[model samples]
Target: MKKLAVIAVLILLAMPSNGLFNFHRKAIHFNVSHEKYVPPFLFWRWNERNVVIEYFDIVRNNDSIAANITAYLAIPPSLPNQEIMDIEFEPEPDKILEDEYGQKVACYKLKLAPNESLEIGWRIQAKIYNIRYILLPFLVGDYIPPDIKEKYTRDGEMYKIHDPYIQQIVRSIAANETNLLIKAIKLHDYVIRHLSYALDNKWDDAPTVLKRGNGSCSEYCFAYIALCRAAGIPAKYKGGTYLAELPPYNDSIFHRMVLIYLPNYGWIPVDMTFDEWIFHHYAFGFHSNRFFALMTGGGASQYLNWTYNSHYESVAKLDIDSTARWLEWK
Candidate 1:
């Protein structure tokens, strides 16, 4: 395992292409380098009660022959407003690992016999807080700290940070603009005005959305990330299920949001589409009274793959839901 890890690192270092790489994609750009900045100490605070995430997965083997499968479950981290105090998993995760995206994840590998059913449970105990707008850093370092640089600043396949077209747009937006915060705000504004929110089932690369001028949450996130990266800013994404208790469409649904690194304040949430839809009243720097993060970063989750697999659909099924029934919101 150590040897494999070493080889992977070496491959990354030796690869001719510049910027973040998506193992699943086969595109690369040359001369890609990352940049950084600092933001003002502007922020607000909110509070959260009992916030919890749970998953009930049932796998059935309808095939005439037995089969084996591997799956992973995201273990919510203690982030911004959500603070996890406990975790419970039946037949507990086989083991956990820091995935390619740099987020810690729990994995479960199982085998089922023909005509058999396998059940799994995952739960978390936690409280949520509201620190919507990020403020000056509690921990400060050089312009863009290594910790932040490693995860958020780097590019991903979806971000397409090195795409020539994306680089041009970001450069045009930041022209003669030296202030980091202002640049980010400007980019946010640009995205709001440029793209119309049209839901797309598949994730689109940043350049594609920018050209098409319309896309859903993933598109918004991808476009924002591309712009940030082009301007030498650190950016990243978070995927989870947010309480769809708001206007327009009010039904439980899965969602995605972006986070950009600002000196001093660190990573700040940017829900561009949601913010604009509400005319920037809520969201943007912060979103939601309740958000259940299933995973973050740009990559695929093994568990998600299981659900997307056509073969698996005929043989198994997955069920997941999160709520805050334990905590008193009133």
Candidate 2:
């Protein structure tokens, strides 16, 4: 009897749950919406690598007077595409505060004597993920959240979205385009074709770029973003240092790009300058992990976009020198 019972138990364990001992076993069926569908083949296609960024600023009191300096250093934030693994400061900031955009601002206050200098900076270790979303133009829905549109499309300091000239340009370029993705691409191409790459000392704004017909990388980004926003496409600024292994490192050399929000794909990077310069052909709707993105939104300050913010009050002349550079960390 015992032997027969053991054999029965073994048979029960070996049998499929639905075949013999089925108890509350239910079949599961996943109904994925087309808007949020990710193909199985592309689901796991993500590459990750680490990079290090060193941003430093030097404040020198040149005149025969003392000065009080308040420096607000921008610390890179963790985003969906990149993660801050670790951070180290040269001599630790006096205090750290979070800006409205969730970017960390390290505040340093110092009293520098005449001919004295102060250097403040931070080294950030970040892991950047190269995850390219295969965007199907037909699959991109045209619905943006009301709040997103309200926040991104509104007129800001440099982004003159509601300006008459900007509206006219938007109408001419993307007015007839129904697909949001297609409209964005048209605007990107228009900026690339309309503007010439030239470094200017004047104000960097959308209308100025359109009128002058020449601007640097930041101008290209501004022009494209303004057009997109005017056409009711939510877009924002992305500022960072391009990580390249050539010509050494210089603090003054940084890059700017634009990120437009797609209904299904979220934020997609659009690099018109890169496309124009042939650094990355067909760069729209695609972004590589070759740069360190420091800031995502703009218009928080009058003279600063996505970089560090500094304010100093002194009775003497102050000369501030800043440098930002990055390299891949092994």
Candidate 3:
């Protein structure tokens, strides 16, 4: 009887409890580096112009990883009476590293373009170190509450709970018969119009922006994410490097931008502050090519959180491709 009781206790201990006892943690290390080599070119005052950009990137990691990288460039549009040029994509060299597990880690290389043919001259080389950990908390649905359990049953109001801003936005949309795309556009526009871009201010938190109505690129992104998530739009935060044209005497370092996930388009880059600044000031229209995006979302306690560091040194080399030609519009 005693032997049987001991065996039963051991079996009970082996079994997972509410799916929480079966969870595991994983550790990964990753590194990404970029370099650009651009040949000098002249700019002409035509309705449309064609230019080719070239880029090279190298990434290294101790483990396998998967991530998305975005490269932005200003391309001339093809419109009525506009000349269009075909953009080309060329392959670049990729470097790989192996781990002790003897498993070949995954690596991804992508060339994100503004349009299909107009390939921006940029290369994003990524190295990923991934380890799969079984999370027991998901087995018995221990992570979710009983009330919220029924909410996830369907994709309606029950599932979309506790977001005041989203509720308000949805109400407005329903009243006006507006679609989701239009709502996102209008919401972004509203954010841009209401907020001002001021790099001098140091606050990058969402609550700070909500109270002060001012923030930097991160704040802009946080505010945007909060509003989007509140609307049940499934939004996330993206932080990475950007290339911006610096003035001759200006010593500003690093550029930042925001990316939101669109249902049909996956992730789309939006530079609300840049667009607003250009629309209002017109003096700064060009972004740098050496800016490299590093991380996404806010919970980056493990990796280096570049967005929070106001004085982080930039590893970008800016070379002026053309002479300054300021345009004045009424």
Q: What is the alpha-carbon lDDT of model 3 when measured against the actual structure?
A: 0.35
TM-score of each: 0.71, 0.79, 0.39
Model 3: per-residue lDDT, tens digit, 52-87? Answer: 222322222212232223222222222111222442
Question: lDDT per residue, candidate 1, 185-244, as tens digits?
Answer: 668878888899897557678899989999888788889988987786788778766554
Candidate 2: segments with Cα more than 4 A from true spot: 1-47, 246-248, 279-281, 302-317, 327-330
Q: lDDT values of the candidates? A: 0.61, 0.68, 0.35
The local lDDT score (0 to 100) that residue 151 gets in candidate 2 is: 78
lDDT sort, best first: 2, 1, 3
Clashing pairs in 2: 251-324
lDDT of 2 at 32: 30
Evaluated at residue 250, the lDDT of candidate 1 is 26
TM-score of 3: 0.39
Lowest summed lDDT across 10 adjacent residues in model 3 is found at 129-138
Model 2 worst lDDT window (10 residues)? 38-47
User: Over the stretch 1-330, how does candidate 2's per-residue lDDT look in tens digits?
Assistant: 353344334523433444232334322122334455533321111345677778777889998877777667777777666899898988798988766545666777789888999888888888875434444555667667777778777777577888898999888887888888777766777787788888764547889888989888777877887888889888887777776664245546677788888776677777787778763224664456676777666555422343433445567799877677665544
